[model samples]
Target: MKPAPASAPFAGPFALATLSAPDGPPFPALVTPDGRTVDLRTALGDPQLTTRHLLEDWPAVLPRLRSLAHDDTVERGTSAGLRVHAPVEPRQVFQSGANYRQHVIDLHVAHRAPGDDRPEDERRAEAAEIMDRRAREDLPYVFIGLPSALTGPYDEVVLPAWAEQPDWELELAAVIGRPAYRVGVAEALEHVAGYTIANDLTDRAGVFRRDMPQIGTDWLRGKNAPGFTPLGPWLVPAESVADPGALRLVLKLNGETMQDESTKDMIFDVARMVSYISRTARLLPGDLVLTGSPAGNGIHRGRLLRDGDVMDASITGLGTQRTRCVTEVTP
Candidate 1:
């Protein structure tokens, strides 16, 4: 495991994480605000406790976790050297696409066809108008993501040999705490357990089907590669985040800042996105709703991921994720 970055300590009063030694099985742990870790399995006296188990009964278990956070008698250790895994083992993942206002506009301007005479300003204005209408009238464009794609925040990502244009998309993930079906936007947030960081890595080359344009995106092939999603240093309880819409998201590539934006740019806020998903599908505990990525993707910036590159992604209140990239070795 890579050494923890010298960044600010988790801002939340307490958070949850999955951690282990280099050769041991992963175990659920509680992270104190000061950056110390307590083994939940041992501390809670539930040897089989997992982060998912807590989320399954989040309303009932949250108070206990709060008590544990303030208990000074429990043994605690620094998380600096331990192997940190994705905080929750989500059973289902829902992802929103093109939900950021500026991101969509930038994509529109960057992907203009060859010899198109429209000025950049005109194209941007047109896209912005479309996005404003989407915010008011259209439903979010959401898709499913496989759980097998998840990896730890500090783990290594093996870029597949076939992916020619691998890119980075940093996003805020909402962790569900309660079952929600056909819920309204006003009640959607009541089901959210917390917030975390996710880097939705994509292979631009495989996003669309050239031969079957009508069939549209091939997300399973383009985005579901193992370790494609580097999620969580920890989960900050929703109560700890004063305003999810105001938090900042920043992603740096090889020490150079690439994406810097705020959730305020989202066309649809968390409540709207969650409620929209619940209208058609039942959202259960431990499920993740990725709000969507902001602008500054490699496709827009003209610089994609390469072998030995490092990405440091973070959101306010939520912890940081540092993932190193390496090209896959084919035998």
Candidate 2:
């Protein structure tokens, strides 16, 4: 007889790391009993700690790490947690455009397909659309930003006075734990260490990066504004994710649900994106892959963020990230 199928695992108990507000030092982490303020970075960086060591091994070390969280020796707190930051620092960031069919249709309509629909006009439109798409697809929409743009879990996002067209995109960010290149989709997940939520903040007003010639069209200026990216509350272990494609994702502005979606809406899917992106550039350990966002973006309505706007994005299993937007003159 075949061996009985193994039962699914559960982290009935676990420890999480968070910042020690009053202390402000990186050596020690403030633990949260209910998984609130746990710092995965501090936990993973500590050589003397066994929990961090097991995390490096993943499923093999999961059960034992779960047991350790129950120990009273771990420092615990109800609050005083520092604002969260993006879980990993990536060397390069690539974003997808119109990755959801609904978003594609919306973007197309918003721009009015650019021409009349007569038979001859239709043929020309089709050709142009194909050309435009091919040009963009020939290379994944790539952009670079500094780690300075990254904000912590509950950190406030500042909307610079120059960015009047601020918008929020709720996306799923994959954290690569292993370096990979030309890996098959079947084996791509192995290189992923975990997942988290990322808010790809954009400035529609076009003033954020006017110094650069290409500032208006793509992400360089729109995406690289200081405090434009708000990420994390948790860096969920991959094993805890039941099905990334099935998970429910959501974004809220000041307690108002704005973007509610499912990972199932993705056009390229996770593995295919990883496979395709890796073929051109080597994906190093700690790199981040930000999957595309779904529809309901504020840009569709010509509405942009102003001062005092609060935004939050959450993926199932990965937990929620909350950011408050504040506007101020550039220093």
Candidate 3:
């Protein structure tokens, strides 16, 4: 863990993480608000406990963790040099797509016909109107993501040689603490354990089927490559978030601010998105529900990722993820 930023990563007194020493196997840990870390396995006297175990019984385990947060006798370690892994091992990943109002509108305007000469404002207004209608009448568009795509916040993102337009989509992810099946919007959030950050990397060129245009987008090919999703640095408890709908998301490429927007721009809020998914699939503990990214993706900006490009992504109270892009080397 790096030094705690001047501004706290989360509002919670403590957050959860998975960390290990150099060459050590990852283990679940608790992170103090100031960035100090306490190995959960050691602190709780359970050498084999993982974050998944904690989440499986989050309701019962939370009270114990809360007590640990304030204990002064527990030995603590600095996160300065430890390796941080994705906070939890999720069995299922549900990803929402085109759920950010401004992001969808931006894509709509950017993907217009080549010869079209409509004014930028006119095109944007038209897209906005369409988005407004969708928000009022349509359900959220979501897709499944492979767990293999998960990677640590600071890991290297390998840009597959076959992908011509690799891009980034920084998003807010909800970590499920309770099993939710056919849950309604009113009670959807009650199943959430906490929130984290995820950068949903995409291969834009592979999004559509060229051979069969009518088949539509192929998410597996475009978004599920190994290490495509860089998730977490911390999982801040839901009670500490105050209002998940208002968090700010910011992504920087090589120190240049790229995507900077608020969760307020989302067409479907967290509760709605979670509830919508629960209607079809059971959301289990440790599962991740990734809300869509905000505007300013590479495609909209005309600057796709290149080898050595560094992306620093952050969501208010959830911590930041800094990933470096490296081109895959073929044998």
Candidate 4:
């Protein structure tokens, strides 16, 4: 993929995007109802208008931002189409692992247990039991991701030459608005400022630690490659989404639909995942909770990402992303 043209008009479902104007610097821009771009920094008259600031003061900023979205005639730039940057420069990114029910089932079916020769139905039944136990215990598996891995939603992804099996995991990332610690599910949603799309690219072949068996998974080595996390075409405010757990996520690889599933299939919804994580870590404003991806990944289809593969991923009302896979030249 090539660099974005100087004038890629901001016209999409994104409520707000951290973007830079042509020949200008970067800032958070709000997309008005009439498809105009209002630099949040200028609109609010604050040079530091960023995702983190808006999120921390969302309660007071919401009304002001909402006002701008309705009145497009309030002196905005029509031709100031901006290019997207990463939505938020998060300090902490908590990513859920295996939070999608169907995705887990798909993985289990694809990699069956050896020698047991148990009936398929029996295996599925056991998996279901495990899921139930985990849910009931309020135990959700989550891991940390490096903020340095983030890139713009429309950026091209570079696959390391040594990575044999690269894959994509499209997920809905919840932007934390308020500081939360040990919050319960009932109030978890209160901390979310809005939502965005994230493509958690993975190097499938490096997911496990063969030499360090006791250590298990290695997300940092397999998932935290530069540009591995392509985030946001925009961030739709939390109020805009009627139900956080009722959205659909779709992904296409080279124009072929690879992932088509809904957030309804989550083993633990956004609220639960957020609340569960808060028990241990202090989630600050702008931190992201990437509620795991849905089914239909490259590994399950017996196909993996390669050079020149284009990924078009989108979530209901959040926005779409066009990520091209490129090969990084080995030194």
| Best-matching candidate per TM-score | 1
lDDT of 1 by residue, 1-331 (tens): 4746545546667999998986888999988867788998998889888898999999998999899899999999877768889999988999999899999998889767558889999999999888888877856889999999999998999999999999999999999999999999999999999999999999988888878878988999889999999999888899988999998999999999999999999999999999999999999899999999999999998999999999999899887889999999999
The TM-scores, one per candidate, come to 0.96, 0.76, 0.95, 0.92
lDDT of 1: 0.91
lDDT of 1 at 41: 92
Let me know the TM-score candidate 4 reaches against the reference structure.
0.92
Tens-digit lDDT track for model 3 on 1-331?
A: 2423535667789999999888898999998877777889989899999999999999999998898899999889878778888998999999999888889888878777558899989998988887788788857889999999999998999999999999999999999999999998999999999999999999988998888888989999999999999999898899889999999999999999999999999999999999999989999999999999999999999999999999999888888888999999999
Look at candidate 2 and tell me the lDDT of residue 92.
62
State the lDDT at 236 in candidate 1. Answer: 86
**Candidate 4, which segments miss by more than 4 Å at Cα?**
1-14, 79-81, 111-120
